[model samples]
Target chain A: MLRDFVKNIGYDDPLEICLSELEALLQYNYRISKRSAALLLLQEDPEMFELVRKNEAERAEKIFSIIEKIKPHYSYPLAYIISERRQREASRIAAAVTTVGKKGSLGIKEALSRAMMNPFIGGPILLAVMYYGLYKFVGNFGAGVVVDFLEDKVFDQHLNPVFIDVVNRFVPYPVLRDLIAGDYGILTLGFRYAFAIVLPIVATFFFAFAIIEDSGYLPRLAMLVDQIFKKIGLSGRAVIPLVLGLGCSTMATMVTRTLPTKRERIIATFLLALAIPCSAQMGVILALLESRPLGLIIWLSVIVGVFMIVGFLASKIMPGELPSFYMEIPPLRFPQPSNVLRKTWSRMKWYFLEVLPLFMLASVLIWVGKITGVFGFLVRLLEHPVRWIGLPSESAVAFLFGFFRRDYGAAGLYDLKTQGLLNGNQLVVACVTLTLFLPCIAQLLMNIKERGMRVGVAMSVFILFFSFGTGWLVYVALNLLGLNL
Target chain B: MVQYDKDDKKQVVPLSELKPGEKGQIAYLQAKGKNQMQKLLSIGVIPGMSVLLVQRFPSYVFKLGHTQFAVDKELASSIHVKPVK
Candidate 1:
């Protein structure tokens, strides 16, 4: 396609002379136009320089000297000067071709957008969205009602007994039968947890996220939190990944690649690993602490306090440039129903597919550990730390399960809570510890893959100690204060 | 004459100092950090470009070519502009 307006390549006389001189020296077959290639060369693009070296090997040195020679003529960087000229010409063309509508009166949409960005109004609006969309819709409706129906009615009553009976009748050997339908078996534990518990929570969270995202509210939310984020050594740009971490930290870990600086990415990753709980874990935790408001408050304060402290410390430790953010805030529009539903469906499908096999594998691993007595041994080892955090030794099983998947561990905690095994203070300590625990296997792999082995392993080791260390402190503090509920 | 020009240049302030709803023509962007300069330049915030301040809270939101960009105070200070009459 022909551009409507020509890009005046040389903004000034010296630039024009350099472009022509470099264009004449070009000998290679290039993908883009020679004009564009010459412009890139002037921008000091490394790839273009290599291409020129390979194609125009003899005159590559001359091209280099020309760039060097012109450096003295301009006070600014050559790249900046070139880009500035291009922007000037482009803006001129844009203004010439486009006719804007009546300007003067701010429309309702503008008023609404302004209100959403205003701090006093935006803060309350954010809380309202979280309360209605996340707490009521996702927590109560999806996690509480839907999960109860699926888990208690569908899987527990009908599916498990039938599967166990069938497996018992068909399989003669006890070990093989245990593998198929026993406790911790693939069908009984894995499928039940994945379908009944995690699925509903994840689906509702993704649906809520998609609606907010499509409405163009995410950027406004980013703007609202930019100040708080700056103190953590990140700009508003990091909000996307940080907010998305609540939906799925594994995915959010990968999204950290979008951050501008390595320092910002590392800090964001560490925080995500340490404090953020994905949707399924969050739903279960909310359900666990629903009755104990004080317990819930304590959990929130400790986790948020750790997030801020760790982020600050990490930013200080990792010396790099503070990230400068610039984002195009799209105009707010009513989310199209079809778009929101499609996005929600696609994300749910992707998440379900990624987790299904892993959950199954985890179940099989747990079963194997059980038969070999390794699970018992591991549970015993975890019991010491569990007790140290003021949790009953039985809660050790949940902490063990937590390593496989955060949601699964949270489910284990839920079971113990139902059995009336944990007290309020112990419950609060466990929740805080689990919330600050290491990222799930998927997130760990992602952290290693994104940040490499050294940093990734170091981060997990630090998180492990920090989570337990914080839990111990909370336990002692609770006892000392005599606030045991 | 030189003194008058110097005085006039002093009247131009950093983009960070502009009140919300103000408009300015970018005069000079003296970002000391290389990456910061590159980031701002890539977003078309060069000298001679014009921007309208959208909001000055939590962060500074501005408009250029129908697109709104947000930058914090530190980054905003790096951008120098002469307020539009």
Candidate 2:
């Protein structure tokens, strides 16, 4: 194979021949290739050293000594020198085998790639996408419309009452009825939250995300955000986790494994735990401020501001230089509708399965806590922080619930919003605090899985204090400004 | 760049597969590069970049030169070859 591409060897250096021989030696044993073997020889591969040594005891020993003698003269670790040559051969062949024409893909694709990468212009375009793709389409259309039909019209109004009656009549025991079909019933809160709240919003998000991912919009997004993210010591790779964080921070935490350094991972994980909120939280927030544009601006500004500021501070504290950012930008393809739909469906299925169990488990835990009075005890403990932030005592329950899952807290807030229990200022503080709260159990588990328990616990404590601290500041500032919703 | 490995252990293998505090030889590289060979020859990846799969996972960790990269499997596939050392 190396011979076929060998148009010319420039010079049959002894090292090259030795490597070729080495490759053959390895191949006789059913190995991959010899050229690769030879390259590894030049690189002075430690593993292959034993294999080569055993192949030709005296000569291999002699060659090893010579390699050691000559190794330092070359700046490249021998491995790179070999790979570079192969790459050259590949290039030479590619030049011979392929040709490019003046014409290529154009119109929308090229224009979109450019637009998505440019920061100044791209920022607003991003916001527009957020507004439509996220706020209007997902929040209003999916969660608001689809969810209402499934949760309220179909389940709550029509199905729940029927199920309740059937369970009550069939099950004579009150305690058993409560467990299966009553207030703490799995069929009620668990299924309702999963189907109604989480499903619709996630379905829409996956739809939008698939389109963006397939179109190659994500890398461009990384390019656009590189500067801002760089200030925080993350390169474009951080963008993947950060962007995915919007969909599900737990998943994003796992994806952070793609980043380059322990330092960067720590920083990314910290920022994620503290700042990035998932799709459901984003949607609920948007809906909370949907009728109030100014309020939305304040919320966005605050979150972004905190993101930048905290990121800056963390990068400074962590010991490592910013990694150079480079990512393979796959050619932008028109996002196929079917691909988008399939991706959305698959992700929704994953999200639903993951969340449904957690929701049911959470309901059971809550039920037990309620029965045991532990729920009130925990809520009371949470209320002190709630009061410190100037939110109503009821908001403590949401904060307490936030520990179970971040979105669950948002759902609790949504229930409160219906009762008009919060104002613009209070809402802003609540949103900021909840958004910055320690990541849910899943993300915490991911943090432990990826970064280990020490970093995970440290991150959790940092987030808890930081979130409440931020909330306290926001609450004080709002009051100082005398702006009341 | 070198051609991708045709073997079973595709570049998609997690970086955690690499041993800690160990080095591997660059057996090959396959990328669509013309000057890439020259560039690699210059850098020494020409079958001898001293391919060290450093600090795997938490970042596709690699340490070379005065630099380090958290390389993903996507990048690894572009530069093929068996680990020799």
Interface RMSD of 2: 10.2
* lDDT of candidate 2 over B29-85, digit per residue (tens): 454443333333443344534455643332344544323333433344454445555
Candidate 2: docking tier: incorrect
What interface RMSD does every candidate have? Answer: 3.6, 10.2
Chain B alone, TM-score, model 1: 0.87
Please provide TM-scores, in order, for all candidate models, with all chains considered together: 0.95, 0.78
Alpha carbon RMSD to native, model 2: 10.7
**lDDT tens digits by residue: candidate 1, A1-485:** 23756545446788888778877777687988777788888787888888888878778898888878888998778888887777766767767877998798888988989999999999999999989998999999889999999999999899999999999899999998888788888999999999999999999999999999999998998888888887888888898998889899998999999998899999999999999989999999998998998998899899889989888777777898777666778999999999999999998898989888888999999988998999999999989988899899998998888889988999999999999998899889999999998788988999999999999999999988899999999999999999976
After superposition, the stretches of candidate 2 with alpha carbons farther than 4 Å from their true spots are: A1-12, A17-31, A34-67, A73-76, A104-108, B1-85
Residues A1-485 of candidate 2 have per-residue lDDT tens digits of 34567553432365555555454445334174556565656665566777777776566656566667655755545555455555556657766777866766657765675556555677888889877887788878976888778876988788889889999889999876777777657777666767778777888888988887898777666755665677788876788888888888887888888886788899988888888989878777776776778777877888999999999988888896455554544557889998999888888887777788887887788778877999989999989999999899999988876777788788888778889999888888899899999887777888888889998999899889989999999899888888775
For residue A375, give model 2's deviation from the true position in Å: 2.4
**Interface RMSD of candidate number 1:** 3.6
